[model samples]
Target: MASSSSSSSSLNFTVRRCEPELVPPAIPTPHEVKLLSDIDDQDGLRFHVPMVQIYRKKESMAEKDPVQVIRQALSQTLVFYYPFAGRLREGPHRKLMVDCTGEGVMFIEADADVTLDQFGDSLQPPFPCYQELQYEVPGSQEITNTPLLLVQVTRLKCGGFFLAIRLNHTMCDGPGYQQFLSAWAEMARGATKPSIAPVWRRELLMARDPPRITCNHREYEQVPDTVKGTVTPNQDDMVQRSFFFGPLDIAALRRLIPQHLRHCTTFDLITACLWRCRTKALQIEADEDVRMMCVVNARGQFNSPLPVGYYGNGFAYPAAVTTAGKLCGKPFGYAVELINKVKGEMTEEYLQSVADLMVMKGRCLFTTVRSCIVSHLARFNIREVDFGWGEGVYAGVAQAGGGSFPGISFFCSAKNGKGEEGIVFPICLPAAAMERFSQEFNHMLRNKNQPQTTSATLIMSNL
Candidate 1:
């Protein structure tokens, strides 16, 4: 999450941008409104999520201008993914719908004085001047009646470019957005249509007739909005930093687990480790429940698997909770088990319950009390996209958590400075916790002899 040279030096650049304009589909789309599923209209996804993809220059394509190619590709791509060109509108009962108006999405062309190499070895999250890279049109940040997609392509000094896109989270989840993006890339490569067709079966994920709440959805449960200690930091005090877990780092984590539980995924292992380290760094009181939420792609969870190109929100946030004391005091397996349980319990019925709860609660936001949410974009095929220039060097979320709140991190599949394949996840904490987290996290990877710290043990005695 830490920006390389983002804060340190006198690194400076001026971005010259053209006036933003609306880009519509090359072919006309039907003019009608499409109702969004309960999951899509949830409170948590009511804003635009920004992403940045850095593409290095390709000698073979030196003559072509990426800006023109991408801009044209986006126009052609929108013909099939037309909903992205529409504006979202809210209906009665807080439901959301897209007015399939061909008004188009916001697009801008720009050139930056800095080259890709000037950004240094890492181009991960917490990118410097991210807002400039993915500029928001005056009222485009508003939830309704605005462009569902905001795109800005800034050519770098070395001929490489940064393709920045901000899509309404309500329109699509990780997979959905990736599908749309890959199609755009295909179009840029002169493909008349996407290799895989896009589908708008939002109705498939809609709440069952006479919605019923079956599962106990703790992720969204409203609780006392309290923080007893200085564990949770103010938005201003938070700092972003990323940690890369290569194959060796993962092997080290697995060493702590029993052979049976070692079958758990790299995500489970790392999330558990992070939750424990963060909880220890926070020093949250024992007996106080600390929560961790994982964004599970529920496409296959349905009895009938979701269509491949059905680009809608197909993920669910299932939460795992345990007291901070137990989390930090117990062995690493304790945290891993909690995560495993949350993953195992999610089913089609569970997703339906989430839908029911959304309507019943009038679209309440996910619970934030003593909690942090983690979303993984590693398998979204970000690095596979090619706009003729070729696959990007770095492609993922533009930044860590939103400015309003902290503790939200993203997992991206990337190589380290040493070019080792692994997962790179970024975390934002108050300066003090950040230092402690870095020290402990590095200590874990470097020295296996050091015992896991046992703190807040007294609180473990309580229920």
Candidate 2:
């Protein structure tokens, strides 16, 4: 094992690359092929998703070295997910493709000198400490040189361990990647085969012709092109916070909406509250059109749903746009209506139309300064991943860097050491706006006469 020390007093770790093992047998012909769908082409070329999960000490895990178990399972799992061991190459048409050269995924082993409790309750630590746990692939900007996935395992002094993962978004979406992780965990637990085998039929998402524009696509047109140049606040001027909402809080939000809309799902209600609070926090011009960009899974929206194991970008980007003043001034039900309207509009024809539009434009939709992107992961089996040690105490997405666009939040399930059920929001905002956002968010929870919000606050304060 390799070790390095950190300057921070909180946590320190040393990292070293583990020996690489190729998955498939070497052959004269390499598995080189283009991606199934061009939808991924619109994604930022160099952007990757980073996640960290902490597993507390367990007797079963302590008896067997977690590193060895993870290594053995990962190597075996890659046999099926071989494309992860390959490099990204440009096809003849300048599109990206996976060149299955069997270079192998990057694996790093680290020794953390701190205990799990000492690392704190929030899974996300400061960037310095968090970055060390994740493996950074060299030459990440160069497609051909970058590995599709990187894994880091850090063993803590308390017997607990942290698994940091970095995966190229171009290769797969959240659900697809989660499936891979779940399968790997199953292997680590000694399963001979994964319960769900991944299917790589990307061509199934290809666009159709006549370029149908079946409903209004004003959402895409509403996104400003100048968003790429929008300024990001300095790290010192930014604050990241996590807020939890229990069943009571959710019910209260539903009550705020009209009876007609009360039937909306819990996700719709919570997202509406977030949109309203965030809009108020920013205090943008009343006339300014603020939008909430949401990612909708398109797998089941098709007339004939995609396979359960379909590992591709089976998602759509839909936005709910309204003036900041309208959002802040209207009753909570208004925001819910806007969101539900967009959700309801996502029919089979609508999704197909969006695909056709993207194919025609040869680009992906972009968000603007007025846009706040939100992702819901509460339904994903994030807390269910077990590597023989036990279920993770905390598992969620980690920020890529210190700075990010003003408003980005991920809603996931929360396990606060207690047997309570709640939803947690990992949010990033400008420091100047966090205080107000927190106040507004808490106000809604407390006004619901919910006691769980108090517990949620205590949990966050400990972090």
State each model's CA lDDT, in order.
0.80, 0.69
Query: How many clashes would you count in candidate 2?
Result: 3
Flag regions of model 2 displaced more than 4 Å. Answer: 1-4, 7-30, 44-46, 92-94, 124-128, 141-144, 210-213, 222-236, 400-406, 417-419, 448-453, 458-463
Using all chains and alpha carbons, the TM-scores for the candidates as numbered come to: 0.93, 0.87
Lowest lDDT 10-mer window, candidate 2?
454-463
Tens digits of lDDT, candidate 2, 339-437: 877876666676667767666665544555667767776678677799987878767676522123445566767665454677777666666676888
**TM-score, cand. 2 vs. native:** 0.87
Best by TM-score: 1
Backbone atom clashes (below 3 Å) for every candidate: 3, 3
| Best candidate according to lDDT | 1
